[model samples]
Target: MAPIVQGTGEVIVIMGVSGAGKTTIGNLLAEAAKCTFLDADDFHPDSNKEKMREGIPLSEEDRMPWLQGLCDALKERIIAGKITVLACSALRKRYREILRLSDPDHLPGRHNCSVKFVLLNVPVEVLSDRVNNRLANGEHFMPPSLLQSQLELLEIDVSEGILQVDATQNPSVIVKTIGDSLIQTKASESY
Candidate 1:
């Protein structure tokens, strides 16, 4: 596959609710783009993981610090001139804004950092099945019971310039859709 972005310092965030194949697609995308891959779940605090493991939904307060940490990590990669692909369940608009790496209050003048978010739009039934399967296989910590909470928290705004891809499609097809969208975005911006 051709490089998705021409240069380093680009961050692609593969976002969705749990079991939406964010990690799977993120790894593939990072390999295809020849960049780094960071799984947001790896950065989650133990407390957050415990809450989710117990099937208790986390509040915004439980997520702010985690989001900030991810933002910082992404910023660090950008400053180092390294491309990074992150898998994050950025369920809310505000959460995504935090991950954009351009918050003036925190990192001033870092607006030059290019961050794109691709939302994996999977049906609730598919998500539930995936989550249950992962749980049965002991592949993840999150309990299947929290899927509804995550679905409730999900908010996709058309104005956010997020690229929504069908998660039900083959992983390669989904990655290609995201890549094509990025190429088009770059092409349009050049004009």
Candidate 2:
């Protein structure tokens, strides 16, 4: 699923580098859609956070369980017919594939739910600014120190049906653009 996705639902995953505003915009998105908002960061184990706080990057091994947990949680909501927006640093294709398949109802035409990927593309300079602001206030784990690793893991898979947005744009404008797409998708569901 490189570009055009084939499933349906109100499951939208906001993804980007650490400082790309996933949680901020995701909250607005969840509010607009009247759905639950989940942050993947909360799913991280104590050790992972500790490692990042120490200015160390988490190996993929350290992230597997957390990623799986997020996938399972979202899958449960999809099963209950509940729509939600989640902030996940789904930076890799394989990681996303796991979440996309966690729903057993995802077989063939039976799955009327979708997992939309909205990628925020921010320049390194802008990401630095965001991280700087965050650190000044007390945010850790996403220190500017970890930025290189995030960019390294960041993959541009346009064929995966992702909506790529420039992170430099105003958050409200970005959310509105995606909101229109969500509205169109919901309207088609009643058919």
Taking all chains together, each candidate's TM-score versus the true structure is: 0.92, 0.87
Give a tens-digit lDDT track for model 1, residues 75-160.
88777777888999999988887887532234432333377789999999999999999999999999999999999999988877
Task: Report every candidate's CA lDDT.
Answer: 0.86, 0.79
> Model 1, 85: alpha-carbon shift in Å?
0.6
The segments of candidate 2 whose C-alpha lies over 4 angstroms from its true place after superposition are 1-9, 107-113, 185-191
Q: Over the stretch 1-191, how does candidate 2's per-residue lDDT look in tens digits?
A: 01112233447899998899999998988887777899999999999999988889999899899888887888887777677788988898888777777565554333353677789889999899999899889975677899999899988665676788877889888888788766676568779
* TM-score, structure 1 vs. true: 0.92
Q: How big is the positional error of residue 127 in model 1, measured in Å on the Cα after superposition?
A: 0.7
Model 1 Cα shift for residue 171 (angstroms): 0.6
- The Cα RMSD of model 2 versus the native structure comes to 4.9
10 residues in a row with least lDDT, candidate 1? 102-111
